[model samples]
Target: MISLVILSFTVKKNYTSASTNSFTKTINTIVIDAGHGFRCENGCRHGSTGENITEDQVSYEVSKRIVAELKKKYPSVKIIESRPTPFFVENRARAEFANKNKGDLFVSIHCNFVPKIRDVRREGTRTETKYVYVGKGKKRKKVKKTITVPVYKTYYLPNPAHGTETYVFAAHKTDDKEEIIMENGDIFENEKDDSTINNNINDPLIKQQVALWTKQFFANSVKLASMMEEEFTTLGRFSRGVKQRQKGIWVLQATAMPSILIELGFLSNSEEEAYLLSEPGQQQMAESIVKAISRYKELVEKGAPQPPVNNGKR
Candidate 1:
């Protein structure tokens, strides 16, 4: 299992200087990644599974809906899919595809899961016979004893941890993010020429530029994640809020552009699983995401100042 970690970092002078520049960035291209799919080597790679539904299936369904809705509402904006079908796509390959297409934002959809709660109860008592030594030394003799033993039956219940949350890459993992940005500098709309930075990654100026871009991406990711959680909350869903893991999520950090992975809800919860599998529930989730993306685009184009990054509201 992949565990998540959270940490905090302060924004640097470079990012502050860059943020004051003219608002030239626009969210022209968005990449939507369905969490998992079928992998031949490992068979099916469903992220999490419920009694009758799987995370891969739910993610694909929600992603497809989001694609359709975005196309309908923002016809001029280009939308790309990381996994168009229920087939495996390597994590690195997915990030490369997003960068290659010059995606402005990347949204990876997934389901949350927790182990079922185990409950044990004494169902009844059973009679048992055992041989025991009766008294002391010579007087002691083998005796048959009848005893009653309590029998316990264990059962599983769905985990109660059901809610929606979003994830951004950890701040301490900036090196990985910086390397990706250095490799694909052109993806940063406000940054210098791709070749210039890529060719002079070791140069002090280029290194500073990459670091600024990395921080900007992190800030944007946190902003977008917060907006998504807000949307989920507005839709009457519990919001676990934005989160970051100390260990980097490959899809989130590997992409050059701002990226986030959304945990729609806990599939291990029976009620949430039914909700995720239902048509209304899926449509509502897609709508919430689409709404958030629309707002994020507007804010970015308007040059809205990014909110300060913190430990996040868990």
Candidate 2:
């Protein structure tokens, strides 16, 4: 199991300035993370697979198309990919890349999966021979008897669950979010100077600032996630809506920006797997993501208050 490191900090003063302080009016850099990667020889880190298709394969393809579409639509925006190849990258490394690049937004693409359901049926009956005692203890005798038993065959069928959902960092994991912000304070700094937040992390005032900034990041993450799910719904795809995992996702909370992880569809479902593996399906998914980002960019740059996120159901 993956472990999260949580840090404790005390806030003495209410830093209202942190709330008003905006990271940037315009989003200049966006990070695209293709979830999972090829399995190693040690039989670890392999992502979900079904119908001979792997989650890494689908995510990588979709991420590449998203990059292409975003570049075409918004030429000025800089795009960085966490995994440009199929090789496995640690969660820490992916977050580090986004932080080092000073990404304004982070999007991680992935396919969902559930275990196959077991299906059992009685095929036919067969004859079996067994030994049985025919009498009492002293006079007991072993006898061979023939009996018929039902034969059952078990097989696995694809799971029926299919849909798209978006995930932001769980609200309860704000401490982890604050820790990430403090560690990469430079990314959130408005000005490049000697008095950066990193220099005074131990100060109560600095801790308060980090806490407020984390709140802002969380709100923005929810807004972006809702928008992505809306786009998916518009395409007539089943939208599972925006969600927060009780167990924190490392890459989502560790990135020092508005971040989201998208579950495109379930690979264990044969129909959805076929759709995800098709050319047009990949293009459609990529276009929907780009459209959402375009709208999010406009809203943030205009300094407009984001619309309240609803349940995101159609």
Candidate 3:
């Protein structure tokens, strides 16, 4: 199992920094990020707006349920939330908060956009060019060809695009994830053992290992993502499968934790939108997330000694 492979802790003797195989300490705390808030400008919603229940509202609702279920199941596990209200939190700030609180995992929840008549927007680009003189003396002369770049707009109209999908930072961008994790060591707090505190930080190999650990995060992210999609499909939700999204997915990369951004469903689709706003739908979403997390936690903790961890924190 991927969980068994990842749960195996790679404890380097006499080393400092985070434990690459530190599931016992790492999975003790969880963080939930409810994506984008409802903000109106000129009587129009600015982001993820549809079906009367905005994306943020649905995410928030689903997140609250996830928190409740996690607590109900784990009891002693610590849970940290990025937002406690219907407010907007910048992606970087959300990641920062998760790290500051020493969250072991970060789950960002969002509803996919269902393009609509109102959701449609126009955007396009054009180009222009000029020619210079051949010789130095001739170059000094003002010689250019005139051109008029035409303007165009693509109407992003409403479509019946709906599904439950999960995302991780583009795995190919491993260097970025490594740098982010290294700069913010709090994510690796599990490595701050008294024994390894004095371990040399100058070792080139240790740095390499730290970078390799980031790759593991990508792997784990993908693993958990697949689990969520599978869970959703089992529940009769249309699963779009997992995908790597680099653009517009900052929290996944910026957070120094195993992170995943989930698109619960598309608001454009009536049936999906109804489910998203319904209590049962929200609860199911939360259940899927909790199940995935529990499976992951169990797999990683297998065979590994359950060292007592005082995870009694907010």
Candidate 4:
């Protein structure tokens, strides 16, 4: 029998920047973005299968659960949701909401899409245009796993890759945490060894500390990603590894908090698409996220920032 092994560690409470208590610094405001609406309606497709699923619908389902879980724990915490219903919202509006509210962290949830390229007979000019769409058919059938064969100028746009991803906005300049990690080793030398310190990618003490913090962030993210992937996998979800992207996503850049985007799976994957559109799949996805967030809070309380969670078990 195959066993799923999940590694978790308790993190010590982290003090805020002002040297206040960990509880004081911990972010109390969270902005949950359910992604932008695809202007074209009737819902998006599940790849070439013609199974229809709306982007707005998926976002709402995932965000609702995240909000519910957060509210349960952080009752006093402020929660701002971009869209609670199946409505069209723009990217700019999403960014502005987080900014105006002074939200500490902004997490924008979205599904990935890869369009197909096809020929267009516009104005008698037979030029190629990139336009791929998913549509619903009269009846639903089992999803097929095969490549589409195109003739003539029927360019096949690659399918959108799925799996989970967490992105942090690129830093324009050094952050305060990075600056501190650079100036001092005496403060943390007792907790971490020289080889461990030297192994830091940036090597700068300040950068190292930031790296350590980010690593901790990724650690928590991975746990959540794993949980989601596992549940989704059994239900036919894709297994995209948890990765960090430094590009500036509007939500990631606008918030003052450390945030990442979790791409649950691709709508283009026939098998995964069907699973995601189902009710059971959405619940599992939400539960995975809640577990990850709860675990992160627990880690922060334990002060286990640098190394992987070293619990007694493997």
Top TM-score prediction, candidate number:
2
Instruction: Assess the local accuracy of residue 233 in candidate 2 as a C-alpha lDDT between 0 and 100.
Output: 94
Winner on lDDT between 1 and 2 is 2
Instruction: Tell me the tens digit of each residue's lDDT in model 1 across 148-265.
Output: 9999999987678989999999988889998887776444333322224335557675566567768878888898999999999999999998999777799888887789999999
lDDT at 4, model 4: 5
Model 1 global lDDT (CA atoms, 0 to 1)? 0.80
- What does candidate 3's lDDT look like per residue over 1-314, in tens digits? 11211222232432355555643334777898888864544344435867577888899999999999999999878887897677776677898898777666889998888556544333454567777564576456656865657665546566878889999888667777777766654333454342242252335655666675677777778888889899899899889999987563778887777899899999888788899999999998899899999998787656665443445520
Please give the range of 10 consecutive residues that has the lowest summed lDDT in model 4. 1-10
lDDT comparing candidate 2 with the true structure: 0.81
**Cα error, candidate 3, residue 55 (Å):** 0.4
Ranking by lDDT: 2, 1, 3, 4
Off by over 4 Å in 2: 1-24, 39-45, 188-196, 304-314
Displacement of the residue 103 alpha carbon in candidate 4, Å: 2.9
Report the candidate with higher TM-score, 1 versus 2. 2
Give the Cα lDDT of each candidate. Answer: 0.80, 0.81, 0.73, 0.52
Cα RMSDs of all predictions? Answer: 8.6, 8.3, 9.9, 17.3
- How should the candidates be ordered by TM-score, best one leading? 2, 1, 3, 4
Give the 10-residue window scoring lowest on summed lDDT in candidate 1.
1-10
Error of 3 at 137 (Å): 44
**For candidate 4, lDDT tens digit of each residue in 166-277?**
4444443224323423332222333432324434425344343354544443344344445544554555555665554544455554343345576666666655577668
